[model samples]
Target: RTLPCSGRNLLPSTCGENRRRVVRALATREPNLRPGIPDLNVLRSGIAAVLSVALAWALRSDSLLWASPVSVVPQQWITEQRTISGVVVSVSDGDTFRLQNVGPFHPTQDRHHEQSFPVRLAGVDAPEISHFGNPAQPFSEEAKEWMKQELLGKSVAVHILGRDQYGRIVGSVRYTSGLFSHDLATELLRRGFATIYRGRGASYDGDLSNLEATEINAKAQGVGIWSLPDEELPAEYKRRTRARAF
Candidate 1:
């Protein structure tokens, strides 16, 4: 007799015997099964794992560093410049600020819906503010105070560059009109509140010559942090402070 499904000849074979052999073969080849469907046990395990991840995601109160599947499509980074209009709500420091009521010039479905978020000034590095009992970097307070007086509650246009690792938008902030029409970062450099940040992996499409020139002028004028004979860069100051703590 020959089984119709498998087309295999079975001498003195019973239907029950043929069925048992077929089941055994399937079990043996389960790992290499076509269509990639796992056996019942493995399928159950996969389902459980998926359920666990979903539950964890749902229960998470804050940011989760979830591992996502590799995407086939290339991610579209913000290479092209974008302009947004918003009023400064808060100044975190000389080079970082918070904006409220932000709206993009060209609205799209993918545009951020949040009314406010942190903005880090591009092409500039400001002195670090005091925190956790660590001494503030030279001119840190002056930088923050200057920003507060000049930017807080003021409407401005943000020339979007890209986002930083801390999720803050990196951009060149400028007033829409008036005497203070130049980029905020350049102004900070001119006032010696910030230095031209040319650190590795820095990304800023805007011309940095103005920032460099302003910084040189500030240093020559002995203004702000430049007045200190041995002022340390903000990054160096942070490294030294952290080293001292431990």
Candidate 2:
């Protein structure tokens, strides 16, 4: 019987295979062995290769570049079967907010950090940052800041709509009201903070939000967000997104 020469020929789990392959590859690359001078050229080339690999690993430890794509890492189950309730940790500006959801849900199954979900307001667009301070309007920053203040550190409820195109939970979010006076999005519109974002006809959600929008506008000529500069109109916001300007 012939002795195994490499890993391909070995049965399995041979610790010597790696060392054997490396030594064989080194020898194959330099067929002639100098008896006394130590084969400086081949030795130098081997050292250079080792140093290059070491350098790449060292750099990858600190930077994402040169790192292997983590495509093979198995994804864990995240969406579970319990309703979550918590104070909003932060509002990532209009349309998206984060919730803590302390007790009602436990992350015994999730592998992600910080149990926060991004929420999208179903029906509106408030003034964009670019809409501020021009002859067009004055409250763009104030609107954004107001949204932050209201949602952050306050109680809110989120209805999970599964995941969206941007990996956010496409859900309806409303502030916590002891009296259940209004949902968060409707109240935001009433206070002139957020505007309704109508969905495409095919995927339109319940008409409740649409009616809320009308009621909000009926009050005080669209007082808060309704009074934004016409340049920052809802239609323009849609175009800006479809056009991918921002």
Candidate 3:
């Protein structure tokens, strides 16, 4: 007798349960099936089970929609946002690094034309390192060196927000070792190597109070960048550099 309802005709959401039921029904009536002929029901179920497992694995492999703890990526960037894990290949400055082996290609991959992706620490801005032989800001090299020591060769989880105007990925980075974990931006602010990003177009998705509190404490102690009686904000420095270009 033909196996009625192979579940291939049903809606996708209902297929799993229906398939399981069909498999159970077939198992119970196995002896009743033709003595010499093969049972088509068992073969069909086996195929279904394998296909279902493959589909599920493919979906899980998609890094673009993996669920994560509350991220700093703004709501507008959700569709293009995601999390990726990779080893830190290089540190550009206090707030930027290149991550390699991020696993699976993504639409928001930086335009750097390389395997490693560039990521900017979200919600904070570090001192600017000179480009094109321009003057470097105070503690710029220190910031870079500190980041290298902290992140170089270590694995990190990057919560991608979106691309910056420079085409670098803007996101939050979390570093976990043993039983302790810390957010990269928060630590930078706590040490005064960076400041709360007050620039326009820089927005975060969650509560801003914690970052603000960390900055306040760092400033109170007058450490790092805050130690300068009249420190030039990174934004101001960039603006000044632009004005001089003309």
**Whole-model Cα lDDT of every candidate shown, in order:** 0.71, 0.53, 0.75
What's the candidate order when arranged by decreasing TM-score?
A: 3, 1, 2
* Per-prediction TM-score to the true structure, in the order listed: 0.61, 0.50, 0.66
Best by TM-score: 3
Worst 10 residues of 2 by lDDT: 68-77
* Model 2, span 121-211: residue lDDT tens: 6555555554333233345567667778767766655544446577665555656445664555565666666556655621224556564
Candidate 3 lDDT, 1-246, residue by residue in tens: 333454555533445676677667767873667677878888999999998996677546646332222233334444567676766778989899987643334333332325566788889899999897679999888888989988887778877777888877888888975689988888888888998898866855363788999999999999889999999978888899988887
For candidate 3, what is the lDDT? 0.75
Best by lDDT: 3
Off by over 4 Å in 1: 1-79, 103-115, 176-180
Q: Is candidate 1 or candidate 3 better by lDDT?
A: 3
TM-score winner between candidates 2 and 3: 3
Displacement of residue 123 (Cα, Å) in model 2 is 2.6
Residue 127 shift from truth in candidate 1, angstroms? 0.9
Of the candidates numbered 1 and 2, which has the greater TM-score value? 1
lDDT of 1 by residue, 117-207 (tens): 7888888899999888987888999999989988877777777677778877787777744664767887888888988777765755557
